[model samples]
Target: MAERERSVEAMLRQYRELIEAFVQEKISADDFETDYIRTFTNDKCQVPGSEFTVLEKLFFDVDDYVSDPELRDSPEDLSGEQLRERAAATYSKLFGLE
Candidate 1:
């Protein structure tokens, strides 16, 4: 149980770093989305166990954020600014940076 918690915390730290990079414009929205919403989510998104509920939701949000509501019919990606906002928001939520 302790091991699992440590693992989860470690994973969260890695995600925080990635999100910070995106939020800082060190990484492009396209590249960040490719890593975060796609590849990076495959293993962490589900995030079983009730203890990780909020973290799981953040991962899910990132995955689902690929779509823009205004262009629902066409399925457009978010602008760089939008992606940065969300990444910053997610980082705040995940790390209690707010």
Candidate 2:
């Protein structure tokens, strides 16, 4: 039980940090998406208070977020800063951060 609690805490911590970094423009959407997958996708634990378990739901959401063509297009056309801003806004909206 204690071990599970710790894991959940760690997961939430990492999620918050990744969100903060993405919002601050410290990490790109792609980076956040990658890190999120690496951190949570393989965790088979069943988290409560959500429909899809944390791993599966977030993995799919971030994958979709980063995979959008408008978001993933060549940097020359959209620019990194613009892409990051758009991604940040999307993340904020999706997660109710704002």
Candidate 3:
């Protein structure tokens, strides 16, 4: 359990650094945008006909992926409101808004 926690923490840290670097223009937006869009669209989580910009898709992708564990652990643990709250918070962090 401790190892899993540490691994998760490390992954989160790496994700944060990658996002920060991305926001700072250290990486090519084209490459990032392609992968970001692919993840969200291929995941089948987005509503059909939902229009999203590159950044918006990135935010949603991160939030959706990060929240997977919580969702899987206990699907009934989170209400719709709670899930939205979690997604908002996660998106904020990914965007350096919090």
**Higher-lDDT candidate of 1 and 2:** 1
TM-score of each: 0.62, 0.49, 0.32
Q: What is the clash tally of candidate 1?
A: 0
Leading candidate by lDDT: 1
Candidate 1: residue 65 lDDT (0-100): 56
For the record, the alpha-carbon RMSD of candidate 1 to the native fold, in angstroms, is 4.2
Error of 3 at 58 (Å): 4.1
Residue pairs that clash (backbone atoms under 3 angstroms), model 2 = none
Better of 2 and 3 by lDDT: 2
Q: List clashing residue pairs in candidate 3.
A: none
Model 1, 1-98: lDDT tens digits are 69778777766665777788888789886677677755455655344564356555545555555444565343434555765787787777777673
Error of 3 at 38 (Å): 9.5
- TM-score ranking from best candidate downward: 1, 2, 3
Q: Give the C-alpha miss distance for residue 86 in model 2, angstroms.
A: 9.8
TM-score of 3: 0.32
Model 1 CA lDDT for position 24: 79
